[model samples]
Target: MLTRTEGIVLRTQKYGEADLIVTYLTSDRGIIKAFAKSPRKTKSRFGSSMEPLTHSKISLWGKEQASLPKITQSDIINSFHQVRDDFHDFISVSKLVEMLMALSPENIPNKRLFTFFLNILHTVKASEQGSKDVLHLITQIRLLATIGYAPRLKGCGRCGGKGLNFYPASGTILCSKCAGTPVGEGKSFVRIHDNTVRFYTHSIEWPIHISNRLKPQQVILSELSTLLDKHLTYLLSKKLQSSEFLAGVRG
Candidate 1:
């Protein structure tokens, strides 16, 4: 079968000395692994357009029922090379793609998530210097929400009261009244700033390109990173490698 899909190049791996196996997050189909003939060599034909983070319209042929398809043609819609060129942007974009590869399932269509990711990539590509870590945190939180792991940010988890505390393990927010109860054995609760909660909850609704406009304080960014890191690492069961690079550069 022949298929045309709009997708972003999530990542690619080398194959058989000269070929490339590419993974794409498509608008119509979920995730597809398609082989590109001789994409690696200098004069191959499928040029730099298949590089990670490039949004492209791809033409592929082969069946979807059993075996993966071969990408007969590809054209870059948005090269997004800016993120790759700048070290600062690379840290965040790599982590974004890494998380998507780890979390997103194959052969499932998630058009909304796809669009959200593209918007953020555009923002990352255009962002000027000013704590890119803030954008990374906001993106992670929003990505979690997009995939249905959103933490409770408004009202109490137990009593429906406002001005709550966040529990990373339970992925919920609770009122000061309910904050006294055991969130989990050995789990301690602290009063995270109301502003942080507000920002976190609002992050999901914030237009992706505009996410970097509201800057959280450096201390708040640190706190959010620690808490979110713990929660996401626990859920993912593996520490994200791109985080090491991000932290090293920022530090």
Candidate 2:
């Protein structure tokens, strides 16, 4: 069977000396891995279309349930070279991609998630370098919300009580009353400012294209970023590999 779909190269692995295994987020197939024979050679049909972050139109040959399909053709639709070229931008987007792959199930068709990610790539590419820090942060928050992994910071996770502390283990805020409960007791919490909560709420409610309209203070960005990192670490059982690199770069 031959399958045709548009995809963004999430990552690629060397299958042997010459062959490659490419993982992609597809328009119709969510996440899928396809085998590209000898794309590493001096002369190969895939060219640079298999490069990570490249969005391409691809044709795969295999059965519907095949774990790995063979790529027959891949034509570049958008190389997204700019995103991969900038160290800061690439690292920021890479963190999101890591989180996405960790959370999104493979071979599950999610057109909305696919389109949202493509939009993020375009937004990051077009955004000015100076403002990318905030843009990238907002993108992370938005992506989490889009995928239902966003941490709830507005109010208590159990009840609607007001709270300023976020428990990474619970992935939400917990008022003092709620925190006194057995499950919440002894859990560490990050004391957050109301501004961080307001900014987070806005990031989720506002449309992605207009997310730039929001201008948060540096402190708020840092606060929210740290909270998210903790939340993700708890969810994934480890920090995203790119995050430490990003922190070092920013430092």
Q: What TM-score goes with each of the models? A: 0.83, 0.92
- Candidate 1 structure quality by residue, lDDT tens digits, 1-251: 88998989988988898888888888888777888888778853366878888899998899765357888888888988888888868886777677777777788888988888888888777776775777778878887787777667677777778855666656677666676666443354445777777677667787867776677776777767767776666556533455566679999
Best by TM-score: 2
Q: Local error of candidate 1 at 43, Å?
A: 4.2
Candidate 1 — which pairs collide? 30-108
Off by over 4 Å in 2: 43-45, 183-186, 238-251
Q: Return the number of clashes found in candidate 1.
A: 1
- Cα lDDT tens digits, model 2, 1-251, are 99999999998999889999999999999999999998998554375999889999999999997999999999999999999999999999999989998887899999999999999999999998677888999999988998999999989999889999999978899998888887635488899999999999998888877888889999999999899989988877644455567679999
Residue 242 alpha-carbon offset, candidate 1, angstroms:
22
Candidate 2's TM-score: 0.92
Per-model C-alpha lDDT, please?
0.76, 0.90
